[model samples]
Target: MGAGLAMQTAVNAKLRDFVLSPYLSSGFSFLMAWVFLLLLNLVTRQPLLISGTFITHNPSWLWLGGFFGAIALTGNVVLFQKIGSLQTTVLPIMGQIIMSILIDQFGLFQSPANPLTWAKGIGLVLIVSGVILSLGLFEPRDPLLKAAERHAGKGSQLFYQLFAILAGMLMAMQTAINGYLGTTLHSPIRASFISFTIGVLSLILVNLITHAHFSNIRLALKQGPRYWWIWIGGIIGALYVLCSSWLVPLIGTGQVVVLALFGQLVFSALVENFGLFASQVNRMTRAKIIGLVVMFVGVLTVKFITF
Candidate 1:
């Protein structure tokens, strides 16, 4: 999943340009994802609706989750163009863990203020180290994967890396915000729907003001593409938004970050194993396995360890 993970942000943004205005694309990504999930629940006979009155008449600030998401997604496009995807993924994740620590400690963005502790510190270090190791920071990477880095402008790398870091850190905050919003609504899915709706409206206004690019999107609507996989980003993103919103309040954002990282690391390996989404099949390395083990310990340490 190395390539796929790296490209998803940029590809999602680019896909937006092709399918709709940039901001609409951003907002609409969630819309597509919500629709797909609704269909999935229908097909699986799973219950979809839940209580959601607070979403309609809650804090005005609660509506900003999608706005943050749109900016974060667009920042990734620039990062991919400047620093390549590996750096984009690794640096941002590290930034995310750090920000998770800060957010949890301060209860930033309505998150419950969980005091920072030694065990959490140790776990954070372990998780960060494991991520670095899993990415093969000290080891050689594939020549093909390295090709993207080669084309990157050296002068801009640091700036882009910083952008990636900031974006990653913001991701944690966004999740926390969404979690708070979801709690108000009494349903994560409902909160997700509102966030997407607000985001879609905001982007639409922006697009209309900037370039009035409705024609392009209208054309896309008229002549749909043949490929099925282009819409996959929405599905994956919906899962992230929904799960993070549901899990953050239950587990606290700190544990949610660690657990999410673990899941990402594990699923990345699985995706690579099967070459899902045409990502390069990576042979599992002993080092990566060791890193994963360390990350699991980190998760346990973060969630269960106290003194």
Candidate 2:
């Protein structure tokens, strides 16, 4: 899981390097994803297309999801660019676990998960505590304070942090909506394809209204043919998503999230600690190591309480 999440982060970082408009990144990715799936369909002699009714009959809440997704994807690219892969990867898992718990507990947006329990409830408290420790929120003297202020330029670091949180919340919403759609449509891949396709289309329409340059669109696609590996990320991303959908219905959404969180935390730590590929990850401090440990403990608490 950690490796996959790291790859996802790396994919976002690669997207950021191109410096295209946000909508273009998402739009091109969706197009690439569709093409990849089409190629798979041809190889297997199976039709993998979504129907028109799926789009037209979507609930208003799902439409709300498209709104969140547009912001989230754009924010993810920007955040990954701004903060590098490690913190961007770690912070969002914290946000997602908490948001998912609230949605599951309260039935917010009509999610289909069971209510929170004693173990899960304590798990929430542990998660909050863990995030605080992981972020070094209580440190008397933060090591990165001076450097962070110097490097962040113009906008506040708080803004970047908020963007990360918003991205995570939108991700949580996207996950819950996928679960609902899977239950309603009885097809995981179809649900994911439709949801992602609609979100990308909605973003593209917004860009059209804003008069974003057509050249950026072309430029984004041009890079795809030039760098096949980057475009391949979309294929792996789509497949991971499809498998996630299938797993959620069989194993439960919360369980799937817990596993994803564990995967992300571990991989993000390794990538950051070793500075693999000359990534922005700096020397690991004792506090950061402690933070990762706390976060993992919180995950264990979350899983144990539920079981």
RMSD of each: 5.8, 3.8
Clashing pairs in 2: 2-263
Candidate 2's C-alpha runs over 4 A off are: 38-58, 137-155, 209-228, 249-254, 275-278
Clashes of 2: 1
Question: What lDDT would each prediction earn against the true structure?
Answer: 0.64, 0.66
Candidate 1 regions off by >4 Å?
1-27, 34-60, 77-89, 140-151, 209-226, 243-259, 269-296
lDDT assessment of candidate 1: 0.64
Candidate 2, residues 1-307, lDDT tens digits: the string is 4467566556655654563665566556656665665565466555456467976776768656545666776676677667756668766776777787788778876775667777776766776666666665566665586676677663766788777877888888887777677666666555666666676677678778867665754554577555544555456567767668667769875577667777777776676677653356655666766777777777667665665
Q: How many residue pairs clash in each candidate?
A: 0, 1
- The best candidate by lDDT is 2
TM-score of 2: 0.80
Question: Across residues 1-307, which tens digit of lDDT does each residue of candidate 1 receive?
Answer: 3233443654564565466455555555656766765665566555555446744666666667777776776676555435444444556676676787798799777777889899989988887777667656677777976775666654566677678778888776676677787676566676676666655666666766777555565654553565345566666677766666567668775576556665555655665555444444557677777776776687678667888
lDDT of 2: 0.66
